[model samples]
Target: MEFSGNPALYRRIAIAVTLYINGGAFIIFALIKYLLHGDTWVLGWKPVLVTLLFSLWFGRAMYRWMMRLDAQYGRGSGWVLESVRVKLPELRPRQPR
Candidate 1:
């Protein structure tokens, strides 16, 4: 999971993450357009185009950010969202009925 030794793997992970973010952005943008325009087809290409460009533009920044985060958190833990990883409280077993 450590990206420091393997640059190829690091770049690949960044690409995958970029694609995922681009997809999600497109979905949200499209939904918003649908709600506002009452039709998903109208100017639909704009969202697709925008998201594509957005991904391309920010992809490098993302890679850099990931590396910084990886350095900050260390041991590849940065790839895993720390905020999303919460300690779950233990649940006691219910008494047999």
Candidate 2:
């Protein structure tokens, strides 16, 4: 079924194309690097660790940006697939028995 005026077919196609292009570029780069050096050490752990830290730090910002974009342009399914939103609230301290 169609969703929120978005044609599922077209949405799927666009997502597929976007994933293909980005994923293909990553694969190509990795393959070339592997072929040339035959080791991941050139990429190195420090840079990878920094990237992971950056991703963790900025992931929320990225998600909010995408949410705003979706709200503005009426694009994206926006957390529909997952039931949870806004993260689970922190648990409160238990009362004394």
Candidate 3:
């Protein structure tokens, strides 16, 4: 829908989301490996290359999702962060048993 809009912004957001997800997953995976082997390991280029290729698809998916959200909420990518603020419910004290 926003084919004529700011394509750079969408690409940036999608890449950022992709990196965040992949980075977090890599950290968790490394931790798991360390726990199992009791040692840390250096980063590998093969994995990096693999992730880079995978992220292309993931980033496109993220872009599509964001576009869908933007259309559904009638807001651009910039507005989604502030416009969809969720108010927390007040936590009251529980009654005594």
Candidate achieving the largest lDDT: 3
Task: Using lDDT as the measure, name the better of candidate 1 and candidate 3.
Answer: 3
Give the Å error, residue 7, model 1.
Answer: 1.7
Q: Which number leads on TM-score?
A: 1
Q: How are the candidates ranked when ordered by TM-score, highest leading?
A: 1, 3, 2
Each candidate: RMSD: 9.7, 14.8, 10.3
* Per-residue C-alpha lDDT of model 3 across residues 1-97, encoded as one tens digit per residue: 4453565787798889899998778777767877877655525677667777888889998887776665633344345343576899999999999
Clashing pairs in 1: none
**Candidate 1, residue 20: how far the Cα is off, in Å:** 1.3
Model 3 regions more than 4 Å off: 1-5, 39-42, 65-97
Task: Write the number of the candidate with greater TM-score, choosing between 1 and 2.
Answer: 1
lDDT of each: 0.71, 0.55, 0.72
Clashes of each: 0, 0, 0
Predicted structure 1, TM vs. truth: 0.51
For model 2, how does the per-residue alpha-carbon lDDT over 7-30 read when each residue is reduced to its tens digit? 444445445555565556555766
Error of 2 at 44 (Å): 8.7
